[model samples]
Target: MLVSHQQNSILKHESLLVKFLTKYLSRVDSDIYFAKSSRCVTHSFTKTATVLSMANDGTLDALPVVGLAHNDDKKIPRKRVYAWAFWDWATQPFNTVLITFVWVPSFLTSTFFLDPDVVGTAGEEVALGQLAANLGAGITIAGLLIAFLAPVLGQQADRTQRQKLQLMIFTGLLVLTQLGLSFVQPGQEWFWVGVGLIAIGSVFNEIAGVNYNALLVSVSNSKTVGKVSGLGWGFGYLGGIIALATVVGLILSGVLQGDSALTFQLVALGCTIWTVFFVIPIFVSVPEPKTRQVGEKLGLWGSYVELGRSVKRLYKEARPTFWFLLASAVYRDGLSAVFVFGAVIAGIVFGFGFTDLVIFGIALNVVAGISTIIAGRLDDRFGPKNVILVAVFGLVACTTAVFVLVDLGTPMFWAVGLILAAFVGPAQAASRSFLARVTPAGREGEVFGLYATTGRAAGWMASLLWAVFIQLAGNQAIYGLLGIALVLLVGGVMLLFVKAPARSPR
Candidate 1:
């Protein structure tokens, strides 16, 4: 009887092992579907398959940490994944349409917003420089606010499982701010109001992003997280391409023909509507993340204390994650400066017209989307840290080339600028994947919140240096590129010393 029982136990174990290997090996480029059975073969150094639970119907409940939940069906639904990705598509116009390509450069700093007296006395170049400098200052202030609020809010959301709710509230605020932009008529009186509105909108956007990024675990497993992150970023770039193209089409079609202020006002209104329409799918289709044992919730002050303790714990236990946050913070600021100032550089330095800037934005998004998707696969194969390092190296080289070869004119800017765009999305996507990998179970919101806080804490460095460098170089916008490149270089070197997270078993 004892010998027979031992033989039955060994057969069962071998059957389970074969089951896991079959599903794991079947994984392809985009996604991998595991069995609906309430069992998972979690990664372990022992190379042994361990079952967590069992259910008669075989439907698997979510696992801790990585948030892998299997639906009743055998295959993961594509709809839920796409719906989650659409959130990125939805919010992208805030960056591409309002912040980067259209509103700030073409209208806010235009002659309409300048003091008639200053333009006459100081020349348009000097007036534009002042406006640009002021914009940087406003963005810096917004970053500080994000640094203060993100960690506290993130912790509360993680403990309470209110990530989706918080994301919706902040998303609403962001939309309202964009709506408010329509009322920012072009004049000296309205310039600061425009700056203030954009600043507030920026804060809302970053906070909302903290929750959205944390939600990544809800829809992905350890195996597919890199690809899923890349998909979301790709969607964003593709959305940017469409939004910018629509604006350009409107401009060329004369549908948006009017005074400069009215044209820009219409653009802002269009973006607000776009955000509202596309953002609904995420809230509707993607279910809220399941709650876990992330400790008890704390009040505002207690939350801050908790945050401090969490930081200390991270430094001690997850040293690689801690170092990654610090390193990513610096380069992320530089990456942000590229978009925040790209249009301004094109218009002010390269002499790109309104249509030309829009066209350039369209082309930039096309390359960015494609490269990010391709790099996602590379991230899974080579590891996210390797992918990030390569992208940063490319960014540094391209940005430096843009600054040094400025006199070569628009052709040079277009060539090097497109190449620069290609690296930006890949670096951003891989960074998210890296963080997702190291985050502990049930702590996605809090960790990504720290990610946002750290990024925002150092966020002022690039903006400040951009302003400082431009001022030091006689307010030449082209010199600001050097400041951005320097930040990337420093961040890349820091990343080299930080260890990469261990890869999960295939």
Candidate 2:
């Protein structure tokens, strides 16, 4: 009688297992069918899918699952993805040429912007130091502006379904700012104007980015978000490479003749034209969300209240994403500092010249672009959290090495700096993918807006710390490298504690 009873219990358990497997397999089949139909509207699948069973420990309940929100959404079209990625390419010159390598460092911080009496004098370095301080101050103010406005504007975009329109509007303003840069001729009188335009440009670019980043969901699903994010960043780096090479060729070919500053002015004009041409596709291709996420018709002040509520809810519900945003905000400012001050470091500390800076920019972009594309695949395989951790570790190590090995001269910088640049793209791309993986459905703009806000809220840290460290070291710029490294270290440590987002079945 006991043996018979045990046999019956075994049979009952087997029957339940069979039922569960059947239900899970049925869901898989449905997903496959949906994928196939999606490909008909998009493009052929370029990779195979991998299916993993749910974890036994219920971590899925702790972190938002990858496809939870996207399961019901229509598959995004391929053209829209390409169009959206092109926006990064379009804006590359703003970040790459104007902000980082060529324009600001080469022109605004040059002796032409200083008092004639100070140039080539004992006080020249001091004057340049003051200019650097001013630059940092301006950028800090811009960061604060972005922190205040980005989330509120992002909420409005989500509520009104006007992301594309806002993107276009800000993008146009960004272009105008770049064009205005062309008029900032060489003179102490023109110095403040250049600083103001660059600061304003930073504001426009970041606000526009809030909209662009939100559109990641519109262009990709959970399975492809990692690769798609990497692809966009890769395109930006590649575009920057091409743009840098063009500037070098023009300079070498002696095509941009006239005042030394004319070259930068023409470069600004070229970047403006590049932006106008490339930005058109996104405006034309990516459609607005079919419906608005009008949770409530909140006023501008009410929007802040709603944003607060949203933050509290995120902390309670999507804890992993909330923590990720907080951690990334700190590290990303360090990432920005890497590019924002790279040219200055090379020029002032390592004593790189015009050709050297341009060549370094080209090589850095090349390394960054290729690594980011490859890291996308790694992100999908090992998870974005792992990819980010690895990249941040590399950044902290390289940045510290640069500061310690300062006396090793230009070759050391050439070697270590490029490696540092290599990590940047992967970190940036993974952060974007990480957020896209976990953002709740239909709230892409709001979530990504908060992403921007959180980032900007801490954005002043790098610039402020860099400036402070330099001042403390008696205006020695090399010490600023340590400031950046410290931020990255803190951020990386914080990231270690944040829970990883649930993985995609694919």
Candidate 3:
């Protein structure tokens, strides 16, 4: 009976204190008067009840333990967000030129890695199988390495408050790595050299993206993050389109010298120049987010321990973050293989010539860029989960068509493949937005680093399946493309199991 009376008195006092703060501090520092502490709210509430009963001047001073309501939803500048989005545009060539449409399959697999002497005698099929296997192996190795490195590096970046610094250093290295590709001539020896440089560039790109994605929270709040993420992803696809067109124009006009090793080399150099020109905006404008409480300084090994603890904590307090990471990781790998093998399928299975490949790339990027931009608005309105669910389903359906209608030739690839392209960018953008929506405030770098780690951990799925299917199906590129589709199909099914928050947290 006495305890119950004391509880009532505490509740009455807390109500009176809240009313007083609401009236007096509303205009002064309402948020400061009652901000949500980083600690457990239940624990903070218990502490606040004791202070309320005391009702002393010092007790009022301790009010921050039970924050009235800190302004977590403050609007950031538009220019700062655009500056951040430019980073995606700046780096798109790494995907468009090096990994996907232009260089990987068109030139590297056909001209550089595929030896004419060996291919002529052993048959193109046998040579292509070897080339595909080697390409898959190199990429798989790089991804495995990334899985090991990304989380530790991200945690350290969070601790050191060096997201932007790390982004700049690694991104500069990525540009340098791309520029080095300009020297890769058409020869067997140069093939592995090209692969090595590309793999390194891939690593740098992933690491830099960890920081860039983390920075999203700093530039936009919950209401605008989805659109902003979509803006960045859309810019990337659009930039890829322009870059592809430029290369095609240069090659066709004799400016790049068609069929010469110099043509592809010039394309690589152009991507390098484009990266240099555009990445400047992000470095100039988006300032680094300030670091929060740096709990006991951990060494490299200790950081992993810290990461494990964070994961455990996240699972308990933020189940959405943990589940979404697993779900997105699966689908994202399939999305990656779409671009990774898109041109490969066109060049090898569909018999697209260099011009056809370049033109096809232009079309693909245009649809992807435009759809991603539209999806951004939809994401803000209908929620990122809905946007992703729709896009991923479209991808799965397109994948089935590409397989079932394999004999239809170029038209089928153009139609069904573009359908696949339309969804890839939206799903990718929404996944990033979804992560931003669930990320705990002040832990952006660590959470996003885990984001990179989770994705890279499963990165081998598409490439492995690509290699496996081709090997089993008589070294056919069509069979290899089916492997990627299977991955997407599986990922989409896995996503259905994860119960994503139906809407972005308002």
Candidate 4:
């Protein structure tokens, strides 16, 4: 009797094992599974084991799991979305205040004393040539350094989970550097100080931007990326406008009364404050992305080897990305040149004053903000590439009109300038969206770093070319601007040939 009972017990155990295995396998083979505890049904093979174990009170959960995989949701929540967008708002004050409006123009006018309009002499020519050389040399060195190091740093950040920390360090550097601009007194020495700060700040900005961009994947789903990106840009434009407005108010009010040099010094302080305060949101709200461990230890040489391999892979797998980069590099460089010289041309050539320049800047920002917001809808409708083409054409036309109607004074000036500003927002917003379309998953940071690098790579060249044309032509800033128009036209034509990738999500 005892032997018979033992045999029955063994049979019962075998029966339960067989039942569990069969049920698990069947669940894996089907598309749907029923979980009794959660009282919900999931339609995926990968979740079968979890459903089955839950249905059976978790006893069979330890069975060797097979065919398990994870599915990613391509959507983002609304709150985090806004927080992510605000990062751009925080950083753009640096671009507007230090680089564009106050510091650069002041450096050219005050430190160098290069008259915006040099009449009937080689004086203008020599000054422009020297300015071009200095700008070119600075950007070239910065671009080369970024190209070599950005990707490696991105890779290391991915491996080490240090992206947020890197962002903090770089952001702090940018803020400190801008604040340091306060001490740049009116002298030739100030020129060097200005250039050095610009160069270093630019480097840190690019580095931080790369890390910040990499975090996009973690912040939002693929569907919301475009909208999220547009929001960031919109916020950036708004920030720039606010900062510019404040500076203009202070200067115009005579509250900061002093020489032009002292007025500019106050403007620099405003920019520094903007940089420091705006960065607080990013530091507080944005979280670092989770990083996976690198399988093998890499020495410095190994890192270089890996980077070289990545470059090779980039060329092979991302041919479209390369072409886009090439086109973007040329056109973006031209755009930089246009803005860099816009205020100077208006003041010196068109006889615009501080009030006029401030108003123009305000108009540019307002138009650009509206255009960027509209571009999001257009991007979803006709695709980012189509919007980019339209923007590029608009850029070309406006640039040409600027030169053609050079004699129109303020009316035609504001007309053409506003039109150009309209394109600026869409072009920039669409360019970023187009890049987002082509960039591979998991590499947005390194790729955006390249984007920033490419934009800056030939920046000096464009400025140099413009300066040379103006210098050689003598009192023909219009002719120099025409050269810029040609670049935009050519870039637009080239972009037409390249096919844009299929649109996905927002």
lDDT of 1 by residue, 199-247 (tens): 9999999999999998887777666667778878988888777777777
Q: Lowest summed lDDT over 10 consecutive residues: which window, candidate 3?
A: 61-70
Off by over 4 Å in 2: 1-62, 65-75, 117-120, 290-292, 404-408, 464-479
TM-score of each: 0.83, 0.84, 0.80, 0.76
Candidate 4 error regions (>4 Å): 1-75, 107-140, 258-263, 290-304, 464-475
Candidate 4 root-mean-square deviation in Å: 18.1
Clash numbers, per candidate: 1, 0, 5, 0
Predictions: Cα RMSD each? 12.7, 15.1, 14.8, 18.1
| Candidate scoring better on TM-score of 2 and 4 | 2
Comparison by TM-score, 1 against 3, better one: 1
lDDT tens digits by residue: candidate 3, 178-223: 8998889888888898888888888899989998997876665545
Best by lDDT: 1
46-149 in candidate 4: lDDT tens per residue?
A: 25334544655533322111111011232233435456655666677678866776657545434344543663466766766676568657756777777767
- Candidate number that wins on lDDT, 2 or 3: 2
- In candidate 3 the C-alpha lDDT for residue 314 amounts to 70
Q: How accurate is candidate 2 locally (lDDT)?
A: 0.78
Ranking by TM-score: 2, 1, 3, 4
